[model samples]
Target: MNVTEVISPTVKCRVHLHVHLDGAVRPSTVWELSRQKKLLLPGNGSLKDLEEALQIRSPRDLAHYLQKFRWITPAIAGDLAAIERIAYEFVEDEARRAVLYTEVRFSPHLLVGPGGQVTARQVTEAVMRGMARGERQFGVTARLLLCCIRGMTENYDDTLDMCTEFRGQVVGIDISGDEASALDVDGSVNAGLLRAEVRTFQEAARRGIHRTVHSGEAGPASMVKLAIDEMKAERIGHGYHVLEDEELYRRCVSTGVHFECCPSSSFLTGAVPLTETRHPMQRFCQDGASFSANVDDPAITRTGLEDEYALLRRMGFNEANIATMNFNAAKACFLPEEEKQDLLQKLRQAYGVPGCD
Candidate 1:
């Protein structure tokens, strides 16, 4: 599982679709921002310290696990410069891991500090500016997914308005937060009805905006089904629980619902159990379900894209399988066709396929 051994120069395959930008910031960047802002961090000036604080070993509920992100939110505040620096560094880090294209997502709601300081419009512009900088500096084609955190005060109407205002700059909209809280949308139902949220998703779809949902992470398999059936999610984030329903698994495979699988986070959160051997990723792959590996929260999970791939490789995933996963991800991305075609060409070249050119 050594990153160096798997990332040899000969292996030039690229990771094209990862969706969490702020979540992927380096610990050093977090520390630097914390220090500059005079914010207190509970670490010994190491990535391990950050990981220990963020990673929940024995959590009573999902909210306790998600509360960890609140600790890092302050570091990301204070205006465009800080946001831009972290965005640039995030792309640079991805480039080092051989990622040629990426789609990073975040909710601008929390970026604004106390007293409604930073406007939502400003937050969008700052992030897009940083994305442009990353593209120019690193040759990594980037896109943004403006997300709405579930359980936030803003209901569907407010979220729709935000998405409409930043429509062009944002490629899509996603609902992300604690899956456990999402399950609480209704008192008796175990799975939340995304039907209400589907109004925005459908509207985005009509406008040709790609849609994806953070479903089945810690909830029942029915939640994943609702995301696909109700929300028309082209992709599912952390869809580990989908295997619970045979019908849903069949539909997911048959219909090509790309699952953005993150093993490290799933393992740490007790979603797939601790051991990598018993992880649902293997089962999902075996069942012919399309999926891509991702470092859901590189900063918190203390991992990188390379580490995720290396772990899968050790667990008996071949290079070709990894390449297929990458191809699936590229196809599932919310980028322009020309950009996606370019990435497909790169993938073919990396794998030494003759007809790819």
Candidate 2:
């Protein structure tokens, strides 16, 4: 469905708190990187054609969805210049589409160059440089969230250390991979990976760092509970399944734990795993679990926040409901108080007006 048919892209005031650098690059950028790196990607003709070719098409599960990164990682993952450019470009892309605030995430470990040439610290610093430039240029304020592979606690420690090293440049931590993959049926973490995730969570808490875990998207509702109660996350990425568990639902609503709901990514990851007209988020909306509409991996899904908001509108959300989601995103974003207040004021002007309601 065309996004403009659902809502005028220019009219819909927007905010994005969940986006990934690993998946936000423009196809034109990827094609350029591939050419520079001497890699032959699966496409012909112009950058537009390459975009069609590079997309994941239809991934059925989290593992399947992750494989699409293979096309992205080799070209830019290890290159410092590519990392910086991608960061800068992501914010610029969203800024054109009216995103006032965004949170872009990536795994520094994934950028390890061949032959031990590049360090995660170097890569992360380069990313910060690029993002700062993007923010300055576009007026789209952004923060970085470092993600680690799930069940890889040492990876988490490395991520945490990067977060500490970067200080204010980094906003939070997240663990990717399916939440169920790292947990036992009893809700305990597996031996090695479990220990590391727990330790990293503790250290992040001690440091007063923010956290938002990928949970309940594909895992059981209990995974969301574990993320909040055990890991002390302030936000839950794709915690759509929480609606099935009443106690968990009550706790999430009462605690006001924000859910970063990405409509397109939900279908791609098999989180919703259905073809119904209703999106998974409708239930979350009905239950009053706070959420923000996101474009989880914009490039991989070949979509932007406009597409997500379009889907929400098709599924029966009015402009006011979508603005509510934007408000949730702006409030939960890891921005400085002064900057956040500025955004909140902008949102008030954009959303509080007559036609928006």
Show pairs that collide, candidate 2: 153-196
Q: Write the per-residue lDDT of candidate 1 for residues 89-173, one digit (tens) a residue.
A: 7776766778876778887777876666777667778888887888787767777887767667364555566666666557777
Candidate with top TM-score is: 2
lDDT of 1: 0.74
Question: Can you tell me which runs of candidate 1 are displaced by over 4 Å?
Answer: 1-12, 43-64, 153-169, 184-195, 275-277
Let me know the TM-score candidate 2 reaches against the reference structure.
Answer: 0.90
Assess every candidate by TM-score. Answer: 0.88, 0.90
Clashing pairs in 1: none
Q: Candidate 2 lDDT, tens digit per residue, 1-357?
A: 754223234533688878889788877788888887788777564577677765667758888888777777888877889989998888778776788777888888888776647988888998999999998987777789999888555566678888877778898888778676776778664544466676777789889888988888888787787788888898998888887788988888888899999988898888887676567688778876689889988878878787788888888988768878888788887776787777788877776654332
Q: Backbone clashes per model, in order?
A: 0, 1
